[model samples]
Target chain A: MANMIDLIEKSEVTGDFPKFQIGDTLRVFFKIKEGDKERVQVFEGVLIGERGGSNKRAITVRKISFSHGVERMFPLASPRIEKIEIAQTGYVRRAKLYYLRDLRGKKARIRERQDYKKGKDLSTAQVNAAK
Target chain B: MTMGIMATKLGMTQIFIEEGVRVPVTVLKMDPNFVVSKKTMEKDGYTALQLGFGQIRAKLVNKPTKGHFQKANVEPTRFLSEFRVDEKELANYEIGAQIGLEFFEGVLSLDIAGVSKGKGFAGVMKRHNFAGFPASHGTHETFRHGGSIGMRAQPGKVLKGKRMAGHMGDELVTMKNLRVIRIMAEENLILVRGAVPGSKGKVVEIKVSTRKPKALPGVGGATLEEASKNPMKASKAGAKGAGGKKK
Candidate 1:
């Protein structure tokens, strides 16, 4: 928590990442470099959990594919993360959506947040309304 | 043989690299250190450089240490350490010359010497990593204790240096071949990959490894040459100006 550590954390790439918490459906734009070629890959999933703070902060994203549950952990400060976009917000009380892994079909779906646009700004409100 | 500097442990932090690979680094603050004295073969029968680190008020220095600093014609420093090097390298440095993080700039690896965190009167389970008895049906308070001291009458007295419950840590520990991840000259911080001995704020001696890595042949001496050439230029160009003084 020293000033030097703070300075070091500030030097890392915070990029213009969308603010989305747990239970929110999000899409991450990750940059992948192969040799001299660079490309962007998009991963869409539900924000399950987030841990740590500052430069060490990481987030867990889970998505179901072919009836198999897949989870990925990504460091927020990583340079590979080009951007993040909140596709939709879901209504949930818990901070982590780990229980979603056990549920399948009808039990796994999260209800859409009704007041998502109430407190948000006009620009974000429009995006949420469009979703 | 290259000169060394004294630094303080500034806690650990993580840094993400180009490929999104996160590296855990232990930050060390190496303040501007001055050469207090040099030991020549003719005088001390060995070649070494005595360097001082950290600034202190002149009034706080004792008379003996004051006289020692007076002999070297330098300001009083809080920490002093001697680094043994070859006599040929002694001519490169003088009594009043300064050393900083620039001395570790292209250095990939180094040897760190410091006193590890003290855990006083530790038991065999914690100190020596001995597998204590498990808590089961008949296990009692002796579960955490060392099982037996001796076998039969074959060994009358306990063997010397036997693994037992005793003092742990608070000893001079040298971690060798620790990679130097990054050197922020402006912040006077050297970020090293993996952990080093000692806790935060503890003084640590950072020295170039005597055994040079085959991958980096001239890195040790080249780093020193770069530091000697620019002195405090890196600090000036970076945030912290000369002598680690924040702007």
Candidate 2:
């Protein structure tokens, strides 16, 4: 009886999603279609949290623009999302970084996490100093 | 009263179409449907086709219904619905004729009717959508009350059909003009763009919309012609195999 729902759920699976979590810096490339013309727009921000599951999973991205904090939540499985790039690794203690909204300037910064991968944004001295 | 079929609401989900737009669709699973009997003007003084759907065991069949199935020379089914058609269209169907999901192919929209979800013993706000008294301004226990029902002497008692709190839902509800998003004939599944009348797992009656859409390209320009054609006069393949391109 429920096989039809399972068939639709199977078709909606894109099958290509990288393991990126909350507190990770993300560069999302979204495809913008304006009538006949189409373009890719990039939004660089920190992924504060994620909710839902399966095809409905969404990412909440927060970025400080012009000294004003802006947060955008969108479905990660959206067809319009062209690419998702992890720009930085953040070490945090909580699942949702909503407390970052109350902090400002240097206080809003996320502590860098030293995972196995090398990041282009990290300096050689900074990487060695963490060791 | 037009051409219709019986299907059950499977559930709702989203699917990506050609334009990368995710359309919300309700999955409806219609197993093979058959024409059980025909009511004619000469016999019943009305024109309608009794369609039988859903698989049922022969042992579970009662005596009368089992006899009715035996007369039609078809297997027993659990559900039957009558679709009114013109007397002239009565000649199109014979008992034991098979109607497939392809019957809805090329149709742009449809109307569905079913029993809605039951809300037992609901309040006025939940039932009749009555605007209750203000919560503040020293309001007491009547926040969600039915409010004043009648005036004093002029009307004496409350007028008939006055909106009041009572049994809510579990009544026949029809949702009209739901867009036909896609039809998966292979799977016997039709994806409708919007919500149907009932919640999931409810048997719903699907009929051709009363309102005709503007400029929908019907396959072979045939709905009635194709449907009335003897199953052998045309290939039994689905709509895709037909000479018409998929819309």
Question: TM-score of each candidate?
Answer: 0.86, 0.84
lDDT of each residue in B137-157, candidate 1, tens digit only: 888878888887877788777
Candidate 1 has which clashing residue pairs, if any? none
**Candidate 2 local lDDT, B1-247, one digit each (tens):** 5878899899898755434556677888888788999999989999999999988788889999989988898888989889998888878888999888768755666889999999988988999878888989999988999878889998799999988888988999988877666666667777777788788887899998876532212222124344234221221332233113322
Docking class of 1: acceptable
The most accurate candidate by lDDT is 1
Least accurate 10 contiguous residues by lDDT in model 1 chain B: B213-222
lDDT of each: 0.76, 0.74
> What would the per-residue lDDT of candidate 2 be over residues A83-109, giving only the tens digit for each residue?
877777677789999999999989999
Count clashing residue pairs per candidate: 0, 0
Chain A only TM-scores, each candidate in turn: 0.84, 0.80
Candidate 2 lDDT at B90 equals 78
Which portions of model 2 miss their true places by more than 4 Å?
A: A116-131, B212-247
